[model samples]
Target: MVKKKFRYDVGILFISAVVLFVTGLGISQGTPQKKNPPFEIDRFIPVETCADCHSEIYEQWENSMHSLSHTDPIYNRVAKFLRQGLIDNDEIEEAESCVKCHTPVGFVSGFPTRLSDDLTKTPEIATRGIQCDYCHSATSVTKMYNNGLVLKPGHGEDDPGIKRGPRDDAQPDFHDAQYSKLHTESGICGTCHNVKHVVFGTDLETTYTEWENSPYNSPDPEKRVTCQGCHMYQRPGIPATGSTERPKNPGAATDYSDERPHIYTHYFVGANVAVPAMFGDEEKSNMARERLKNAATIDVDIDPADKKQIHVTVSNTGAGHSIPTGLGNLRQVWVEIIARDRGGKTTYEKGVLDAGSELPEDAWMFRTVLGDGKGNPVINIAKAREVLSDTRIKAGEQMRQTFDMGFVPRKGTTITARLLYRGAPQKLLKQIPGEPIEPQPVVEMAKAVRTF
Candidate 1:
C-alpha cells in the first residue's frame, strides 16, 4: 500500500510540472518580441505596387522631395562628400547616418554605408526613396524626433502588411487598413524631418520642432493647421483607383457608401524647386515657386528721425515653420534691396548675386551659421558641431533690417526690396561635381517697392 501511495504522489507531481511548463510556454509566445538594430526590408513593397491603386498619389510623390531624397544629384554629391570624409576619418558608423533617412531601405537592410550616387545601381526599394509600404507598415513611433520609428515586416506578397492610415472604417479588398491617429498628426512627420548630428548630437534640423512651438500647433482646431494641411491640399475627389470624379473612398467598390469631404492631394509642395527643375518636372517646379511666393511678406518703412535710413521688414506670414528652416546652413534666404534714382541707375544694393551666382560678402542672409569644433565656420553639415548664430525668421515672426543710405538719395529715389530664397549657396554648388555652376533659381518670396 505504501509503494502504491509513493507512485501516485510522483504521478501527481509530474502532471503539475507538465501543466506549469505549458503555461510558461504560452506566456512566452504571447509576449511581444523586440526587434534589434538594423531592421529587415525584405517585406518592403516598391512604389509601383502602390501605384496600382494609388495612381494619383504616386504621380504626385514622383515629383516630391521624398522621391528625390535619395536620387537628387545635389544631395547625392553632398552625401558622397560626407561619406568620403567619414571613411577618411575611419568613422564608418558616422557615415551610416546619412542613408538612415535618405535611403532608409538600404540603411535598415544592413548596407547603410553603400549608397551609390547612381540611382540605377542602388537597390530597388532604396531607389524608390520613401515608398508607401515602408510608411504604412510602421507599427509605432518610438519618439518624436530623429527618425525613431518601428516598422513591421509582412510575411508574404498576399499579406495586407499591417496597413495603418488615418481612416478607421476603411475596408479594402487588397489590403488590411486600420486607423492610426499618429498618421494625421505632425509627430509622424517629425520622425524624419528632425535631424541630430551622429557625432556631436547637435540638433541639425528642427523643422518639426519649429512647427510644434508655433501658433499653427495651437490646440484650437479652428486655428490649428498641420503640415499635411498645407503641403497636401485637399479637394473633393476619389482617394483610390477609380474615375477621377468617383466618391472619396479606399476601394473601387460599385456600392459607393462612404464619401469624405475632401481627399488630400499629395503634391508635397515646398521651397525646393532646384531638384524638380533638374528632373524636368515643370509643374512641380512652378508649384514650389508659388508656395515660396506666398510664404512671406515684405514691408518697407522710412525712419522718422533720418530720411536716409530705411527699415525693411520681412515676416514669415504663411509657413508654419521658420522661413529657411531645414538645412539652413545650406539654404539661402535674404532681402535684396535695390534703390535707384529716377535714371534707373543702381544706387545702393544688398543681397545681389554676383556673376558666379555668389552673394556679396555684406549680404544679410536669413539662415543659420554652424561652426566646427575649432570654432571655424563649416559648410559641411556633418562637420558642424554647434550653431554659431540663427537669423532665420520664425513662424509668425518678423525681422527688420536697417539700411543707411550712406549718401543722401535723390528726392524720388525708388527702393525695391525682394525677399529671395535659394536651395543651395553658389559656393556649395560649385564644389559639387557635375552640377552646372549656373545661377540657381532665386525664388522671390515677397517684394515691395516704395518711393522715398
Candidate 2:
C-alpha cells in the first residue's frame, strides 16, 4: 500500500511540474494571464472634458463607430435579443462575453449581463462605448489576441500618470502624457478587435490574426503598415488639445510650436456606413462609403476558347487585414455581376437583391459560417460551437470565381462586376422582429467592366 501511494504521488508531482512549465512558457510568449478587472467609475473622466482642448479630434471620434457602438439602436436590439432569448434561457455566460468588448465600461463595472431597453437608463460611461479613457488608460495588454487589456485608470487631470499615447513629445498642460510604444503597434488594437467565444472557446473574430499572417505585417518598413496608418489618416495639424493655431509640437513653456507633418488624425474610419447613416451623420456615412470604395479592386477576364466562360477576380489591396475583417459572421461581402446586350436587356445576373433584400442562391459570399454542436447553422454567435467555413479574401490576396455566361447574343455584351459590402446579413436583421428594421444599404467597394 505504501509503495502504491508513493507512485501515485510521484505521478501527481510530474503532472503539476508539466502544468507549471507550460504556464510559464505561455507567460513568456504573452498569453493572456487573467480576465479584465472591473473598471473604476471615478477614474473615468467624461469625453466632454477631453473635448475642451481636443475639439477637432473629439468631433472626429463623435462620428466614429466606436462612439456609437453602445448607443446604436441595432446593437441594443441585438443585445436585448441575446439577453431575453438566450441568456434568460440559461446561456448567461455567452451574453456576458459580448459586453466585454461592446460595452467594456459596463462589463467592467459589474453589469456585464444587463442591457436596458431604454437608452436613458444605461450608464453614461457605457453609452460612451469605446471611449478615450478606456483605451488611453490601458497600462498593458495581457495578450495580443482576445480582449486581454490591463487598464490602469487615471484619476482625472490632476493625476500624475494620466494617459499613454503614441506621441512621446506631446506635452499637454491639462494632463500628463506618456509615450506608449504599444499604442503605435497593431497588437493594441488586437486587444479588443480579436474576439473568441466565452463558452465554446471558438474564435468568433480574427481580424488581428488575419493581419498578422498577411504580408502587410512584413518587417520591411516600406511594405509594412499599422492599423492606424490606414484608419487614422495623418496630416500636418496642431495638437489635439490647445488652440487650432497652436504649433503641432508645443514646447513645455509655449502652447504651440512649428508645424509637424506627422500628426495622425483621429477619424477612425472603417467600412461601417449603416450605423453612421442610422445615427443621421451624413458626413461620416459618406466617409465610410469612400473608405469602402478604396479598400479593394476588381478584374474581369473572358476565356478565348470559350466565350461563355468568365473569370472575375477580387483583390483586397488597401486593407491590411481581410476585406471583410471584423464580425465576419455578421458582415456580408459578395460580388454582383450583371451582363447586358446593347439593347440594355439583361443577359445574365448573379448576386441580385430580391424584393425582400435577400441575396440569390448563387451569390458568392465572403464570410464565416458558424454552426452549433449538432452541426446546424447558428445565427447568434454566442451559440456557435464551431466554425463551419470561412471564405473571406485575405490581405494582399485575390480570389477568382468562374461563371458560365451561357448562350450570349451574337452582338457584343457588356459585363459589369461590382464588389458589394453589407454591415449585417438580412437573415440576422429579420430575427429582431417588431423593431421596424430599416433596409441596410449595400456599399460598392469596387467595380469593373468588360465587353465581349
Candidate 3:
C-alpha cells in the first residue's frame, strides 16, 4: 500500500512539472513567442518623434483609423474574443495573427502579444497603430493579403534610422531617408487592405480586390488612381480618380521645406464616424460625415408606363471602390424611400430606422451575408464559414429599385428616395461585449425628391 501511494504521488509531480515547463515556454499562445526578440522595442521610433518636425501631417493622422487600429475598444474586445474562442477551437495561431497589422511594431519586434500578457502596460510606440515610422520602414510586400507587409526596422534609437517614402529628394536632418517607388503605388496598400482568413481561407476583406477590378485601376500609369489618391487626399466629394480632376493640396511637406503642389492628406477618411466620435474626435467625425454626404448620387421618378410604379436609381458615382467596401459583414448601406399624400400624410415608407436605430426587415440593405458552414448566418468574423450573399453596389456601377406604389399618385403627391449609410449593423452592436455603444448616427449620402 505504501509503495502504491508513493508511485501515485510521483506521477502527480511529473504531470505538474510538464505543465510548468509548457507554461514557461509560452505555449499558451500556440507558437512560442520569439525566444530571442529580433530587435529591441526602441528600434521602432515613436510617432511623436516624427510629430515634432511634421506637426500638421501628424495631426491629420492623429485620430485617423489607421492610428486607432490596434487600440480601438471594439477591435480590442473582438480580438480578445477571437483569441479566446480560437483556443477552444484548437486554432490559437490565428488569434496571434492580429499583431501583424494592428500592432506591427510588437509583431516585428516580438513584444509578446499573448492574451495572458498585460496589454495595459504596452509600450507607447506599440499603441500608435500604423504610425509614421512603421509605414516609412516598410521595405516590400511579398504577399497580397492578410498583412503581407515586409518591415526592415531601423537599426536602433541611437542610430540614424533608415526611412523610405515616395520622395526622392527627401533630406531629413535626423535620419536616413530614401525614395521607394512602392510607397507611391497601390500594391503597398493592398498588402494590408486585402485580407484572407489564415486558417479558414475565407476572403474576409475585399477593399483591394474591389479597387483592383475597377475602371479606376487603369493600365496607363497616368490614368490609374490608386487607393492613396482618394483616401489620402482631402476632398469634400470623392471619386478623385485619374479620370476626374483632383485639386492639388498645397502645403509644406515639413518645416523649412518647400511648399509642395500636393502632399497627400493623412486623415484617411472613409465612412467611419462613430468610432472616432466615441474617442472624442469630433473633427474626424465631421470629416467622415462630409465625405459620406458626397459619396453617392440618387434619382427618383415615377415610371412613365406604370403610374403606380416608382423607380429609384442609386449610383456609386463618387467612390473608386465599391459602396460599403471594407469589413463587408459589418458595414450597412441601404435606401430609404418615402411617399406622402397631398395632405402631408405619410402614405408609404420603407427602410426607416426605428427608435432604437434598428432597420426594419423590409429595408433594402446593401451588404454581405456570411454563413457558418452549415448555412447558418454568423455575425462574428471568426465564425464566418462562407459568404452566403453580397448585394453591395460595385464600383462605378448603378442599382435601380422599382417599388409598386399600390395606388396612383395624386396631383400633390411627393416621392422621395434617400441613400443612407451606417458603420455597422444594429444587431451586431448589441452582441459586442462591455459598455454598450451609442447607436451609430445615420448619414444620408444622397437624396432625390419628385412632386406630381
Most accurate candidate by lDDT: 3
> Which digits, one per residue and each the tens of the lDDT, describe model 1 over residues 386-420?
88888899999988889997877787889999999
Task: Give TM-scores for every candidate, taking all chains together and pairing residue i with residue i.
Answer: 0.84, 0.85, 0.87
lDDT of candidates 1 onward, in order: 0.71, 0.71, 0.76
Residue pairs in collision within model 1? none
| Ranked by TM-score, top first | 3, 2, 1
Estimate the overall C-alpha local distance difference test score of candidate 3: 0.76
Residues 57-159, candidate 3, lDDT per residue (tens digit)? 8998997888998788767866776566454352455555676677767666665455446777667788888889888888876556665567677866578
User: Local error of candidate 3 at 346, Å?
Assistant: 1.0
lDDT string, candidate 2, 111-174, tens digits: 5434442446667877788888888887776644446677877775567257788777877777
Candidate 3 stretches with Cα past 4 Å from truth are: 1-37, 81-96, 112-117, 235-245
Question: How many backbone clashes can be found in candidate 3?
Answer: 0
Q: Tell me, what's the RMSD of every candidate?
A: 12.9, 9.0, 12.0
